[model samples]
Target: MPRHVAIIMDGNGRWAKQRHLPRAMGHRRGVEAVREIVRAAGDMGLEALTLYAFSSENWKRPAQEVGDLMGLLKHFIVADIDEFVENGVRLKVIGRYRELAPDIVALIDDAVARTSENSRTTLAVALNYGAQDELVRATSAIAARVAEGSLAPADIDTDAFADALDTADMPPLDLLIRTSGEQRLSNFLLWQCAYAELWFTDTLWPDFSRAHFAQALAEYAARERRFGGR
Candidate 1:
């Protein structure tokens, strides 16, 4: 019953390596996992699911690989948008979307618009996102407001600062899952995950099944989240 769950879909490259398949093939397969997870989350009555689709540092990868990733994104949008709209699933693309290719940006805008009124579920895809960069950007916005006399420096607090972050509209993060047995956050939703339960698994992104997701939720359900209290 996590109100909001975020996942770092890791191990695409490693999965590809293990199978002697091209890296792009792994990325393509990862999209199938995304579809499965989104469906599972909605069926489970989850409020929101935020996926770390691409990070800011991912641009450091090879040009062909990046191109392949973008191509896969485009393919997913085109192939699944109709189903998303029909199922009442809202699609949100967060992070530096303006930096993407114009066509991709247009597709994202279209998908978001088409599902704007959906209430069944919310699926947020974080592309070109970085936690530190998001924090810096939020701080800069708050500073600008203070300098403009629209806000007082003394009024800044955790809630006020969180409002400046990108996830202000979404529910507070309740669970964070990292696949491929990774245990690090990797610059994803740092502000929102302050109190989220953490889960890790060795299943690669392409291999992550609904059973694995259910197991993560089961483990989360067994925890006692007292916030700061004992």
Candidate 2:
């Protein structure tokens, strides 16, 4: 099994539109998909599952839609905390967490704290996260250390830089799947996914099921990941 897997959950609004429902309804349904995928990942024995929950660029979306998304996030954490703790799933949110509303940040902290001891699987939600932004942040920290004469520029290497990433504690990423037929990274884990196998599907987030997830894993198992070696 892949040590770590990441997903770009797309097409929530489009799924809602196709059903003649409001965008918020699609987001609400997408939450159910999140729950299913989390359980499936844990059951499959994945060490970590990183989901592209919200990107920094998502701020450009309509205010009402953004508000609705935040509401769904809060509800997901609050309603699922007990189950997550019981199932040995560790909840973690990565990104500019301080940029979030105080209440939302508090809830995120609570969820993380509540399940910190669980070791079955780590579920990382990338909220307000962007790969470019993450790289910039890491670079800034490295530069600060260099300027302080605490670190030499020549000492920096791939592993050293990776240690500064938000996912430093997580396992190396092995598979990355994007739903809704979107064939792009959309500013997700650019650094971490350097060698991950990519899988894309037209299935929208709300319609994404355990079967679809299983298919991705099966396909991953068939590939030859040489990591640049023959």
Candidate 3:
């Protein structure tokens, strides 16, 4: 099985619109899908599952929508943290997540601390995340170290650069799945998924189930990874 997998949960609003429901309803349903997928990932023995929860660019969305998203995030943490601890799933947040609302940040910190010791699986959520922003931050840190004479310019290799990323401690990405028929990365995990297999499905985020997830894994198993070698 692929050790690490990440997903771009798209089409929540579209799903709601299609059903003549409010966007918030779609997001709520999407959270339910998140719960199911996290459990499936742990049951399948995946080392890590990273979810693109919110991107830095998402701030441009309507204020009400953004607020609702934050509320859902808080609710998800409060509601699901116990299960995470019980199931041995470690909670991790990537990107500039600390920039979120103070209360939300506090909740995330508490949840992360509460589940820090779990070893079975890592659930990494990307909040306020953007691959380009992540890369810039990582590069800036590396440059600062070089300026301080603590690191040499010649030492900046792929491994060194990767170590500066927010996902440095997580397993290498082995597969990346995007739902809602979206075929683009949308600025998610550009660095980590460099060699990961890509999978896209028309199923919307709220409609994504364990069966769809299983199909992706089965397809992954049948493929050969060349990793730049024949």
**Cα lDDT for residue 1, candidate 2:** 78
Clashes of 2: 0
Candidate 3 per-residue lDDT, tens place, 1-230, comes to: 99999999999999999999999999999999999999999999999999999999999999999999999999999999999999999999999999998999999999999999999999999999999999999999999999999999999999999999999999899999999998999999999988999999999999999999999999999999999887
How does candidate 2 fare on TM-score? 0.98
Report how far residue 68 has shifted in candidate 2, in Å: 0.5
Between candidates 1 and 2, name the one with more favorable lDDT.
2
**Per-residue error (Å), model 3, residue 20:** 0.4
Identify the leading candidate in terms of TM-score.
3
Ranking, lDDT, top scorer first:
3, 2, 1
Off by over 4 Å in 3: none
Question: After aligning candidate 1 to the native by TM-score, how far in Å is the CA of 12 from where it should be?
Answer: 0.8
In order of listing, the candidates' clash counts read: 0, 0, 0
| Candidate 1 C-alpha lDDT tens digits along 1-230 | 78899999999999999999999989989999999999999999998999999999999999999999999999999999999998889998889887999999999999999999999899999998999999999999999999999999899999889999888889999999999988999989988888899999999999999999999999999999988777
**Compared with the true structure, what per-residue lDDT tens digits does model 2 show for residues 1-230?**
79999999999999999999999999999999999999999999999999999999999999999999999999999899999999999988889977999999999998999999999999999999999999999999888989999889999999889988999999999999999998999999999989999999999999999999999999999999998777
* Residue-level error in angstroms, candidate 2, position 32: 0.3
